[model samples]
Target chain A: MQTPASFEYERATSVEGAIASLQRLGSGARIIAGGHSLLPMMKLRLANPEHLIDINDLAELSYIREQGDELSIGALTRHVELEKSELLARHFPLFRDAENVIADPVVRNRGTIGGSLCQADAAEDLSAVCSAVKAKAVIRGAGGERVVGMEDFHIGPYVTAVGEGEMLTEVRIPLRPGGGSAHEKVERRAGDWAIAAASAAVWIEGGKIADVGVALGAVGPTTIHLSRAEELLRGKAPSEGLFAQAGEIASADCSPSADGRGPIDYKRHLASVLTTRALSRATARALHQEA
Target chain B: MHVSISVNGEQVSREIEPRQLLVHFIRETPDLTGTHWGCDTSNCGACVVQMDGQPVKSCTILAAMCEGHEIRTVESLEVDGQLDPIQMGFHEQHALQCGFCTPGMLMTARALLDENPNPTDLEIRTAISGGICRCTGYKNIVSAVRWAAEYEAAAKQEV
Candidate 1:
């Protein structure tokens, strides 16, 4: 085993201390939350920092609460917690569904929502779900705090708006008046990264789709919002023909690559299939809410 | 960096470099040879251990991050010369052949069964999906967990 060169470890007592320590370490400092994503990159020599500021002890950043009309999930909340949270099962069941299919049990036990979002892996499940839910990522940097909408968070593959010394503190998802959602994905194996996944959340009022969000994963450099697909569904009757057209639009909108999992055409086909299925299920749930 | 962790029911502290992984700390610092390191990328659960009662891939976790946590390896599964149910199930059900993935499988099973005593076959399979077994083919491992669940059920009924 190759031992990395000497470096310093600072256990930050608070988020402010963590930021200060990161500044002290200059550009070479990196924040360690769950370490699921960062440490592996370190071992593969993809990422090596001079200082590791451990922020796992900041217990305040681990909660799922209903604040105002939105559900605020702290950045450090583990995947397993989301998998079993009754609040999530009620308000944002699509997130819980996505969490259930993330990696496997051991990874879910240690992997945090913020870590996955910060890792920004294109194939990751939660990133697409966040986009589908239109969640806002509350990031705290030295300059104070700012909320970046999930759509604007990811700029490219494995890239995000998180800057130097910035820590993602919370993810706030709105509690829709007629909240109903669904998530579906096609993976090579049970716990493997998705080949392509889709999430659908819609608000239905008086038998008409009021508002809708559609997000796709593993089909582009970053999780993409299928605006054409979403526009087709919004204010529509949520019928099968509309969903089929939406799926067609989604398949055309994405730019998936021909990777080891499947061909680009097959992935686009899957994009259509999974998108229609997720939207159908989400629509069914939305109808139930209207009832 | 000086890190202290309760490993295998013993509080072992060691001064190590910042890059020292938690798996290396357990395998070298404490000299607990039961924990194996197959794939260092955290893909293979060969270095799985109960970190503060949660099963985590030690290869991906920094030793310094586990300064105050309780870690349990395969060596800690035995109590008073009696094997833990997971180990016993492995032995009685012929769950090992080369014994390389046994410790990880056992710990993963321990973590799973501790939280869910009545996991279905698919649940058990998902619980140990992180682990890779090149020898036993996972049939017996699944049987082993099922046997352990039954054994625990019987014991509870007797009590």
Candidate 2:
């Protein structure tokens, strides 16, 4: 039987209360939102925090809304909500696409977006989706709040910009005009982690690509933000040829190690193929050619 | 720590370690052994239960986190010895082989039907995608959920 080591549990009623407890408990404390990722790690003895500050009761931190020009998603928002949010679907269908394939419905009901991002697993789909959408992380500490871009939010494997005495409060994706996003993943079976997944977002203006974001998951230590591919796609007209070239970049760029999912060559091949598919679908949606 | 949780509409309180998982708590505290504990990694759905009316894998949830929440186990599906329509459907459709995956499958399907009275075959398959049934190859399980949906719809019309 697998079980976590004995630890003190504290339930936080408010965000401030949770932060205060985090500060007091210092590095020994960990904030558990959905407990899906954290509890599993705890059971394996991979994560052994001395104290767990439960934030599940902070209902105030659960929301997804349009705040001015950006979409603000509360950190405590569950995966089920992300998958079902029509507002999100209207803006970024990639969320729903990725959520559909990320684990199963029952797990989605209990898993939170905040926890998923914080877990910082390389195979996690949301990190790639967030990176592709240029989402910003809003981290709250006792001093104040600081916003970090997706590139900086993830520092290493299973590591994030969320400091020891802080917590991720919200994720803000800048709403740009003429933008469409899609996520594509290939997994071995239902509810399995991606062998290689790609998330692409394209903003078109006057039949030309104004801006683009492309990222790959499960093919690297952290989300592989395809800056080279984005640079190549920028200012170029959307075409099969341009996307094919971008796929080549993805194949050459990602750093994947062989494991149960696939070998290095297979994952690299998937990275390329999935990136092209995502880019094609995203562009089609941007031109209002596809739903 | 002392944890108090509502299991099948009954409040059960017990003194346990903070790290005790909900699956063990449900079985050992209220002695509701119907909720099986399968994969400790949360991959297997044998440990599924309803928390606040939504299905969650009990093996990964700490009992301490469920202190104030309402948890419904497989034992609740049969009240006054009258099986839930889902159970009846399972029996009629022969949805079980080893019976190990039945409890979790029933709870997961029950939650899905509660939220969606009539789900398509694709929807039923998607709803129970988390569960792994080594027996029956899921053909009869899908039929069982469909049968339950039809049964409930017919019952509603008769009423």
Candidate 3:
């Protein structure tokens, strides 16, 4: 296992206390929420830090609530709970569907939504889904608190817009009336990371598309939002022609690397196929709800 | 740093290095070797333990972070020398060969059945996905968990 050169761990009871401890630890300090992604990467010596400021005790960061027309999910909510949440299922069944494709039950129990977003792994299912859903991340730091769009949160592989000494506290997703969504991914196995994935959500108003979002995963440095594809389907009735065109656009837009998992061309092909499948499934759900 | 936590129905407090992992601390400090170390990393659930009644990879958590928490390892699965049903099921099914993975397997099974006594085949597969067993193709392992679930259910119904 990879061992840190040297490090310190502080268990902070409050958000302010955690921020203060992080400031004291200085440049090499990083907050550890669930540690599902960070600890594994640390063990591989891929990313090493000098200190880990534990923030699991901040119980305030583990809630899922409906506020007005949006759903605010705390960063510390475990994937298992997210999957089992009756409220999320009632309002946003997409999230529950997305949670099913995550790593595994053990990982779902330990992995936090914030940890996954902050890690910004291209192969991550939730990060891609967040972008497709246009979720906003609430981040807190020494300076203050601010909301960042999911598309802007990711800078590149293993990187995010979360600045130094900042922590993502919660994710805010807008609730659309009469909307439907789906997330689908192609993976080597049940518990393995996705080779490619897609998430699609559409808002149906008066038998026409009011909004559509499509995001791709594991095919680039970061998840790609197909704005051009979404634009093609906006205000149009759901149809195979539009989805197929968007799928083609998504395949063309992705810039995946050839790794041990598969060839670059294969991943690109899978991206198109999965995107098409996801959009098709999402569109059917939308129509079904309307009927 | 000094840390105090409950383990297997008992309270334990000790001073440990800040960098010590919970798994290492449990094995070295408290001398509870029941939680085996297969892959010192979190991929292999061999170091799995119950923290506050939820299954977590002990190797990933820092010992200092476990202060004031409740921890339960595979060693606590028995009652007065009577093996836990999961353990007995493993024995009856011959679920282990080298036995390196038994402790972790038993702990994972206990946690799964605790939450879901009657898990579907898919749920059972997902529950044990984090754990790795180089021995027997997991056929007997799955059978053992299913058997324990049935055994526990039947016992509950009798009472």
Candidate 4:
């Protein structure tokens, strides 16, 4: 009874072939990866793309490597791989933290990182994780590929900067010294969407917070980037007082709505508390105090 | 469209609509009703099956997408007249009451034991986190998986 509407399906043998099919199929076609998120929407008739370009066979797009000063992750990499990647854990433990709670292991075995980021669900974990790490998204179209930062990549709730006839190919995270990141999420139950989550990345230099990114999920239309909190934490000494102040800024700036998850005030409070906790953990890891 | 997939190690060719899910394909094509379909959505793990050695929710995958891939269902768990160790563990531990969540739980537990021969209580719970049993028979399920793990280890040692 929950089957999707009738549609045409084709498997893409290569990246170029997939791009070509996307160009030929036009806007009515959507790329299917993992199909964990998209299929559910399609079953509800919420998403009715007439043509599906299956990218599961595109093994070329599945990778995780350090390209110079950045860690480049292929779009087709499954959540399970990301959760267990020793490289990601070493560089950005936040990825493993978020992936651990993203969804159940069975779903994680099938869901891809590209699919999760492209879905751009407000309550999703990866969006906040990427935003906090200041990751750049690579979107490839018929013309060429364009790279967009997380700030520009997320346009709105369930909407991304990926245009028609275009597909997101990779997520690139810059590698910086003295950098550590952490993600904290609270869900009502196991494998549930975040009631309120905060992702924080802190880079320390000369014992001062050189740069930091704080983002909140499920508390707004898009992943809320705490620019004010980042600005406050930057150039400040890594101290509990400064993190508390940053948490205050998060509570003040984030816009959360009331729903089945909780009341607006509760979410706003979580934004502050979780942000503080994430910053503390990130700082601890940055200083080489905890693993 | 005409799609051919290896279900339970047997090639099954069928003409299925593009919208047909992999779960329905298995249940209808080979009549492997042992893989239960529940919650049509992917939240419930009742539709889980081994796709190329990985346990994936069948309801979320399109039959067309699984073309040419190896799919193993609950029916493949038994060899000859002997039930798989996992099946026997479930029976010995009373892992199910209503038996609705049994197939998915078994397949999920099987996949976990394959990857990690030894899993802690927390790990077993985490592996089957995707599965939901209204009977809330999780305690026995964990014990059953442990029982199977011990049985497999002992059998391997005997050889």
Q: Which prediction has the highest DockQ against the true structure?
A: 4
User: Model 3 segments beyond 4 Å from truth?
Assistant: A289-291
Clashes of each: 0, 0, 0, 0
**Candidate 1 or 3, higher lDDT?**
1
| Cα misplacement distance, residue A279 of candidate 3 (Å) | 0.9
What ranking emerges by DockQ with the best candidate at the front? 4, 2, 1, 3
List ranges where model 1 is wrong by over 4 Å. Answer: A2-6, A289-291
Most lDDT-accurate candidate: 2
- Name the lDDT value of residue B65 in candidate 2: 93
Top TM-score prediction, candidate number = 2
Clashing residue pairs for model 2 = none
User: Which consecutive 10 residues in model 2 chain A have the weakest lDDT in total?
Assistant: A35-44
List pairs with backbone clashes in candidate 1.
none
Comparing 2 and 4 on lDDT, the stronger one: 2
lDDT of 2 by residue, A1-291 (tens): 999988999999999999999999999999999899999899889999999999999998899999999999999999999999999999999999999999999999999999999999999999999999999999999999999999999999999999989999999999999999999999999999999999999999999999999999999999999999999999999999999999999999999999998899999999999999999999999999985
lDDT order of candidates, best first?
2, 4, 1, 3
Model-by-model lDDT, in order?
0.87, 0.96, 0.84, 0.93
What DockQ does every candidate get?
Answer: 0.72, 0.92, 0.63, 0.94
The candidates score, on chain A by TM-score, as follows 0.95, 0.99, 0.95, 0.98
Residue A252, candidate 1: Cα error in Å is 0.9
